[model samples]
Target: MITVKAPGKLYIAGEYAVVESGFPAIIVALDQFVTATISPSDTFGSIVSKQYQENSIFWRRQGDEMVFDNRDNPFHYILSAISLTENYARETGQALGVYHLGINSELDSADGKKYGLGSSAAVTVATVKALCQFYHLPMDKSKLFKLAAIAHLSVQGNGSLGDIAASVYGGWIAYHSFDRQWLHLQRQQHSLTELLAMDWPDLKIELLTPPADLRLIIGWTGSPASTSHLVDKVAMVKAKQRGEYQTFLQDSKACLKRMVQGFRNGDLATIQTELRQNRQLLQGLGDFSHVTIETPILKKMIQIAETAGAAAKTSGAGGGDCGIVLIDRAIDSTQLLKQWAHEGIQRLNLNVHTVNDDVISKA
Candidate 1:
């Protein structure tokens, strides 16, 4: 049996600006992720999922055209991965058969089907890695990353592809986009992994779970706002006036340079400043926050978070699924968490992790 686990990611900086400015964006592999286990089987190809119970067991034959069981289809991405697997096997002349594959995700926490933190990407990476291992496909990291990217794009239609890259590559990533193409650049002048593994500085972070008393308020805009669509729109929006856009681009580039330096220097204050400024620039692009996070409820929540002295921003796709809030040192995160609960906004205490340190036990 072969197993693979991949991490989720959070974009700390360069959200919308990364599109227009082609600026470098920083991301961290979160502790949350999806796990896949594949076992060789001759009886039949079976699939089980913890997330979907009833439809978990699917029996099929070798080279049989796999059909998705809509009764418990998590998302179209799963089907895309399956199709890719078949195509890859046929193209590479590998024997195609039913491998008893079990797929599931162990997230830090989730509010049902909330669309934040790259769950789809996690599944895609896990599936791709599992298949690669099962077939013993000698693909390099770049090739594996491309396969994952293709599967992700099949579903999202448009995404930065940074999430998949970070999950597969397992490290802090600097992402860029050009001519409608996404680029994942290597910029680990410093690695949190090497630092943590070596136990250089005992990085101390207080990951506080929001008190159970508070309800995290999440809303779906019911609008399918494509990340690429929003990003491309920003490009078109900024093109009408070159000067302002160029200035924003230059500021973003400078901000990214400083942000990287801050990470290396362990200067949280500078990082926070850059992130705050990046958020402002994203807002200027007008496609920064997703609809759900932009609603009055979310606006009030951010205002409340600020009033309670917390650093907050929309997580993931922003038109909104989740928000990450950092409480002030002097403030009790739990106390503020309770207050937000009183206001009907949900809070989550999540742990941060570095690539190749937390998950990615094996490729």
Candidate 2:
């Protein structure tokens, strides 16, 4: 049996802006992970996830695709990974054997709510890693990232793939968006295997080492946010109002640049200022797009974090999910956490996952 794990990710800055080509976003991989265990199966292949559903899903390859017994499938990301990897092996003159897979995730709430910690991307990466390891395929972080991105984009249609990259590499990273327009057009003409063999030099990825003095606090908003819906809302607004959208993009790009510089130089003041400005810009985007990017709970949490001398803002697509708080080591987080709990926010105990270390461990 082979087991693989991949960490979830949080966006530090450049949320909506990274959807376009050439814009950069900062994301950090969290210690919490989605784990996949793969072992040989004689009769048939099955995917078991008690957290996601009541029963296991039985699947088999029918011709060139994986077919599930039931129509309502919750393991879409895993299926995509398996199908793509199988095709990749075949295209590269290799063969694969069937396996029984069990997936378990630590990225969900106690009561089963998703933490919006890029669970889909994590699972896809983990599945790909496990399958490749099972087959002894030569896979590195870069190749793994590309495979995961292809699977995720196949399932979600549109994404920056920042989360996918973070899961594969595992650490603080500054990632430029891929040319989704080109990828989408190519997908219509070629298969997944053909796409994987092609080189994409336009995508830029850089590793960042944050200062040791930097402190991070994550607070969950209890409600799960739909990134797809929020992204669609923004896309609609961009289509209707090109000038306003361009302005938002420009400001976001500037903010991201400053934040990246702050991380590189360990400038706390610059980081704080950019975070506040970025929050306001996100709120403005919410207003222009007619989507509630910042909820009342998130606003209250930010206010409380700032009152405690920490810079706070909503992470990812907002609406709900988690908010990030940056602080120095001098400030006590006891009162802040108490106030957040009083306001019904759950403080998540998480740390950054680094690429130099092994993110996956055998059971």
Best by TM-score: 2
Per-model lDDT: 0.58, 0.85
What would the per-residue lDDT of candidate 1 be over residues 1-363, giving only the tens digit for each residue? 998887777666666555442456666567777888999887888777767553242334557677432312344566677777566655667788778878777642332443356667788888877887787665555556666766666666554666776677655566654323322221124232221123111111111222222222222222223354445455565667567677777887788787777666656566666666766665554532222325454555666666765555554546655555544355656655666677666654445555442322233
RMSD of each: 10.0, 5.2
Error of 1 at 306 (Å): 3.4
Instruction: Give every collision pair in model 1.
Output: 214-341, 215-345, 215-346, 216-345, 216-346, 217-346, 290-318, 290-319, 291-319, 292-319
TM-score between model 2 and native: 0.91
Alpha-carbon TM-score of each model against the true structure: 0.69, 0.91
Candidate 2 regions with alpha-carbon error over 4 angstroms: 54-74, 188-194, 357-363
Candidate 2 per-residue C-alpha lDDT over 270-325 given as tens digits, one digit per residue, 9 for 90 to 100: 88889889999988888888889889999999999999999999999999999999
TM-score attained by model 1: 0.69
Over 4 Å off, model 1: 43-74, 85-93, 107-111, 177-250, 287-293, 327-331, 357-363
